[model samples]
Target chain A: GIQVEQSPPDLILQEGANSTLRCNFSDSVNNLQWFHQNPWGQLINLFYIPSGTKQNGRLSATTVATERYSLLYISSSQTTDSGVYFCAVPKDGGSQGNLIFGKGTKLSVKP
Target chain B: SQTIHQWPATLVQPVGSPLSLECTVEGTSNPNLYWYRQAAGRGLQLLFYSVGIGQISSEVPQNLSASRPQDRQFILSSKKLLLSDSGFYLCAWRTGTITNYGYTFGSGTRLTVV
Candidate 1:
């Protein structure tokens, strides 16, 4: 079993602002993903970065496996970007790719 | 492309009642399926996951159990429900490969046991 911790726990931002969210895992992971749970509870896939960096629209994520930490960057934030951001890491080298999630950071972007 | 669906988007049942939640994956075969539950403002807890048909691995020994009858079908069942079982249940699936990626989660089911 691996432990994942997300920082801040909650965040508030104004439209056109930018913020960074962090996630740290206890051990190496084979797969890592960033998810955005909207106000309506739809889990939208943001990134699947096990390593390296990826960007989509105004959102970007980077995972430093050597450091066992990942970061999600939301630039020019909009009201629609307000929700819970989750980081999920899979068990290492296991037959099952079971993801252990961290208590997400709830973001509120006010217009 | 794979899509996971969980029935009864929202449910309310009394304690000691039978509970059954079904999940189905379309557009893929032999995909690994997982069942997770999240309490309010908490992380997703791994309840059960299946690598293949009839092979389920329980992560947390709770009142819930999971079954995989078909390659792309998963079910979570309980002989009797409990008040503590109330929460948000999510079903997800991914490809079964050495290099796995992010899973696609279902719309999620909000179950409230009174």
Candidate 2:
């Protein structure tokens, strides 16, 4: 089993501040994804960056697959972006998309 | 475009009560379905998944069981709920492919057992 660990189990920031979250995997992975679980318990897809860099609005992510690490950057965060950010890794055995999730980084952006 | 639907938004049940959560996917057939549980602010835990009708693989051994009666429908049921069974239940589906099948999660059901 692959263990995924996330940094800063809890976080609090001002509305205009920027922050970066990290995810580290214990083993090789075929895919890496980021998700945001809102206060209402809905899981929203953020990014699916197995490698390279991708940006969506004020949020961006970069995965260095060779180093088995991924970084998510939230720039000028907003109150609506406050949630539990999780990183999931897909096993490399075959085509099973079952994800091994990290405990997540709980972010709170105060307005 | 694929969409997943989960119902009841919220539920409260006695410790011994039976429970059933339904999830359905539209615009796709033979998709892979999964059930996950989140305890408070904890991470999502994989409970079960199905590749097709009547095919289920349990990721955790618990009082929970899942069934797929149709290609687009997946159900999670419990014979008797436990206080520990109280959590956020999420239903997700993705296309079964080697390339990539990004999962689309439902709004989730909040269950409380007392």
**Candidate RMSDs in order:** 1.4, 1.3
The DockQ for candidate 2, computed on C-alphas, is 0.72
Q: CAPRI verdict on model 2?
A: medium
Displacement of the residue B26 alpha carbon in candidate 2, Å: 0.8
Candidate 1 has which clashing residue pairs, if any?
none
Predicted candidate 1 versus true structure: per-residue lDDT over B1-114, tens digit per residue: 667888989999999999999999999888888898989876788899998999999988889899999898999999999999999999988754567466788998999999
CAPRI-style class, candidate 1: medium
Per-residue error (Å), model 2, residue A60: 0.8
Most lDDT-accurate candidate: 2
* Candidate 1 lDDT, A1-111, residue by residue in tens: 688999889999999999999999999876788999998787877888889999888889999999999999999999999999999887755557777789999999999
**What's the CA error at residue A60 for candidate 1, in Å?**
0.8
Off by over 4 Å in 2: A92-94, B95-97
- Model 1 sits at a Cα RMSD from the real structure of 1.4
State the lDDT of candidate 2 residue by residue for A1-111, as single tens digits.
Answer: 888999989999999999999999988877888999888788888888889999999999999999999999999999999989999987555365788899999999999
